[model samples]
Target: MMVDVLYLTAAVCFIFALGGLSRAESAQRGNLCGIFGMAIACVAAYLSVNSADFWFILIAIVMGGGIGVFIARAVSMTALPQMVAGFHSLVGLAAVLISFSACFAPELFRISTPSGIKVLSLLEMGLGSTIGSVTFIGSLIAFLKLQGIYKGHSIPLPLNAFFASSICCLLFYFTVTESEEAFLLLTMISLLFGATLIMPVGGADMPVVVSMLNSYSGWATSGIGFTIGNHLLIITGALVGSSGAILSYIMCRGMNRSLWSVIFAPEQAKANDAVASGGTRAFKSGAPEDAAFILKNANSVIVVPGYGMATSKAQYALKELGDMLKKDGISVKYAIHPVAGRMPGHMNVLLAEADVRYDDVFELEEINRDFSSCDVAYVVGANDVVNPAAKNDPSCSIYGMPILEAEKAKIILFLKRSMGTGYAGIDNELFYASNTMVLLGDAKKTTEDIIKAMRE
Candidate 1:
């Protein structure tokens, strides 16, 4: 009863944590709530375990915690997406391992009977391991791709066949045969399916891919939680799985991509891995000094950020430029695309790290129309979000995606390394527009140079 009480309390705390994390102002409070809830859940689990298992569990806790803390502090923000993917793989792998243990020692898990293992228990083991196997390998591929360790550019394999056949076999084999060999073979198939499914996805789709893998990990955890009779794990897993799914849906909508299309990695989506530029389109180039003069005279400026900003670590200098502009009585705001950077909220987090005020930032829907009235649309390391091709080209892969309308601004200051496409690998017609000024250089150095020029 005490364990049940603690579980209920932890569940409530987790709900509160989710509510808190949904808002920027209460995010810190939310984090504290989550940590507290996990602590309580850990205590409940500890109380339920055998005395003989105590030392082993304690040692595991210590080792895992030590590694997590080290990675958290050592990893850079630019690499956070890969870190997250890596963590998801760990969760999935843990579920698979737990299922294996349950299979071997059913009596220890309280599922053995005169009639053999419980049907419900067998189903749980099968599902948990199957989903967990896929999640584990899929997340690993995502991490490798994000970290630039794997070149996953070959043609995508037939995932539809793998997904359908594997699940059908797992269900039938686990329920009818109830044999260990069937389970092992089906689990191997799931792992292979996951690897093939995600390996060929282009970088532009990484955010959605990460979100979907998170959802998979959550569902896998929940399935294993039922096998182990852990209420807290069930509740937490549901929350994470559902939230991840919703976030994935929202991001796909933002990118004008169908969720089914992204998950399946359709032919059309994979076709855009190479550049779509029509052989050396003409565009205007400018220096940091020219950008400085424009900023000096502008009445309103909106900064649009992308993944390039994250790689170049330019958010700090961008924040300084914002402060300088505000000091000189010019209005400044940051425009964040929903799918900007490598993950959801990536740009927002970067801006917050740079100490940019929350009030000055707006999402795609919030300030898109304002670009028309704004004097300068300062695009830093952004390409596709401002591209007109999404609206103009029906044949393009990114067609119908919502852009920031940066082209409508009186003057567009494009900060990028060259006249290349963004992650979507499609050229931005905005770069070649009459109003756009492409300033080629590292974004951080260019922003600093603009600051120096303004002073002179």
Candidate 2:
């Protein structure tokens, strides 16, 4: 009865934790709830086991807890997505290993005469192990790419007989594999397959990749539940897997991309030229004093942030500029697009770190309705989020993706360092908009200068 109660409480906490994570205001609380719930579940699981090997479990727990704490404290928010992917990969790998252990256990295998139930279990174990192994290696590669440990380059797929031959070989191997050794070999091959798959995708596609891997992790855990006959694990895993798939689909649509394209296309080959469109007309650059002059009298200003802000650690400067504008009685608001930075909620983490007020931040939905009302939109080192191509040009790669219509504002101030394209290798149409004024420099320095100008 106590065990049932403990499990029920764990389930409730997990649900609430996930619910809380849906909003920025409650994210921290959600994280705490998740941690606490996981703790309870772990304790209950260990207690339920009647075995006498408590010392081994204690040591494992202590080591795992120590490592987890170190990682959480050490990793920066910029690399959080990659870290999460790698962590999920580990979970999948663990599930696979556990399932494999159960399948080949000496005592169980010795007693069975290969009944239909045994065959089905073996098949499930093989499938789980293969998929989990692939997810593990794929996520590791993603982590390497995001960390700059690997050269972020695209790998082209063979289009002719080589591709056809490889697929045939993989199919033949899968069809013939019935033994545990063959399953292990297949797992290794799938791992290699996953590594090759994610290597061709650029950093810009990481959010979707992370979500997809999350789903794989969940499914792998579900397979573990099948192997162990654990209902709770199965339910939790299904919940995570389904939700992750939905999130991945949404992210793909948000980027005007297909999951297949992301999985298969060469990153460089799939580049979109956003600034080269017919509507892209570059205006004469304005002097800082002139730019300041125009912004000073603006009735409303919207600030847009991107990955560049995180890379340069410029949120503090941005907030300072916002304060100066607010002092001038200009209504200031921040516009955040979902895929603005390297990861999901990237800009929000940085802004929160800088102690920016939650109320001042507006989501894409809220800010879109107010774009026309905004006198000026100051784009800080963002390229794709403010690009008009996402909405206007069907021929463009990012067509159909939602964007901040900063072009509609009477004045658009873009702060960027160079003509070099963003992660998608696309020039920003927002940079060339008629009302747009480019301030080419380091984001933090330019923002600090603007704040100084405002003060003077």
Candidate 3:
């Protein structure tokens, strides 16, 4: 009976946490709530009398905990999305492996007569294993693509088709024959198929891919919950799965691309020629002295950051530059676009970590209004988020995605590692605009140079 209470409490906490995560102001609170709920749930589970082997449980906790801690400490912020995808894969793989084990360990399947718990357990295990195995492989490939270990170009259609057909055949064999070997084979094949399915997706769509993997992990967890008759796991997993799927779809729409197309389409050519040929209109390389002279005249400056900022670890330096400008009586604010990094709310988290003043950070809707009023817009290590393609080119993959209208600012300073396009694999029209000056170099080094110039 107390087990029921523990499960319910876990479910309630998860819901509250999710609600808090909806807004940036409340996100930290949400994260805390979720962690608290998980702790309570684990304690309750431990208290419940179980006929299962203690060794299995102990081993699982130790292994899982070790892996989790290693990932948290080692993974870089720029690689966070891929790390998340990898975590989801591991979760799904756990469910699959656990379920497969239960079927073999008949002693673990015992149930009290009136409860019919054994029947429920078997069902949960079987379904969880099947779905989890598939998700595990899919998420693994998604992780690789996001990390650039697998190139973001589409894989051959024949390979995809072959895997799809193999999975179907395996499923049919499993359905017709209830043999344990058949189940294992199907699980392995399904995992292979999942990996193949995600391999072709490009880096521009990594966020969506990560979201989709999150959904898969949730659904797999729900299956495990059903097997164990844990109502809390089932509800929480379903909620997470559904919300993540919707978010992934919404993100795809934001990019003006269909989910299917993102997963299947070939990578578009980079915007090198258009950007190289476009006649310069405004900002060109002036002397570092000349640029400082212009900055001296500007009354207000707004800094727009993107994924590149995170990769270069330039947020703090950007803050320093902002401070320098402010000392000269120039006003500064940091404008953050939603989806500005590889993960959701990435920029906000990075800036928060840098201890940037909360008041200085403005959302897309709030900051766009000020672009016209600002004298200069300094872009550091950001490309896609400020690209003009989102606003004007229907044919572009990111046409509908909201972007920082930095181009509207009177003067623009664009910093980058190179002339390459951003994740969307398209040229940034803002780079070609007359008002924009491309400062080509490593972000930290470039920003340091600018800071030195300002001081001189």
> On residues 1-456, what C-alpha lDDT tens digit does candidate 2 reach at each position?
676677777777778888897886897898788788888888777777666888898898899889988998999876777678779888878876876676567243332344423555555566667667767887888888777888655556763235335534553554355455666666766676677777778777888888888888888877766656565577678878887898788778768788888777745334454444324345557666766787799989999998888777889988887887888899989999888876667788888888788899988888898889899888887888788877777766667878888888889998887766676666666766678888888889888877677667
Ranking by TM-score: 1, 2, 3
Q: How does each model score on TM-score?
A: 0.96, 0.88, 0.86
Q: Which stretches of candidate 3 lie over 4 Å from their true place?
A: 22-29, 49-56, 59-63, 106-127, 158-176, 266-283
Sorted on lDDT, highest at the top, how do the candidates line up? 1, 3, 2
The residue-by-residue lDDT of candidate 3 on 308-331, one tens digit each, is: 888899888888887888888899
Ten residues in sequence with the least summed lDDT for candidate 2: 108-117
Pairs that collide, model 3: 124-227, 281-434, 282-434, 283-434
- CA lDDT scores, all candidates in order: 0.87, 0.75, 0.76
Better of 1 and 3 by TM-score: 1
Worst 10 residues of 1 by lDDT: 266-275
Off by over 4 Å in 1: 154-160, 266-275
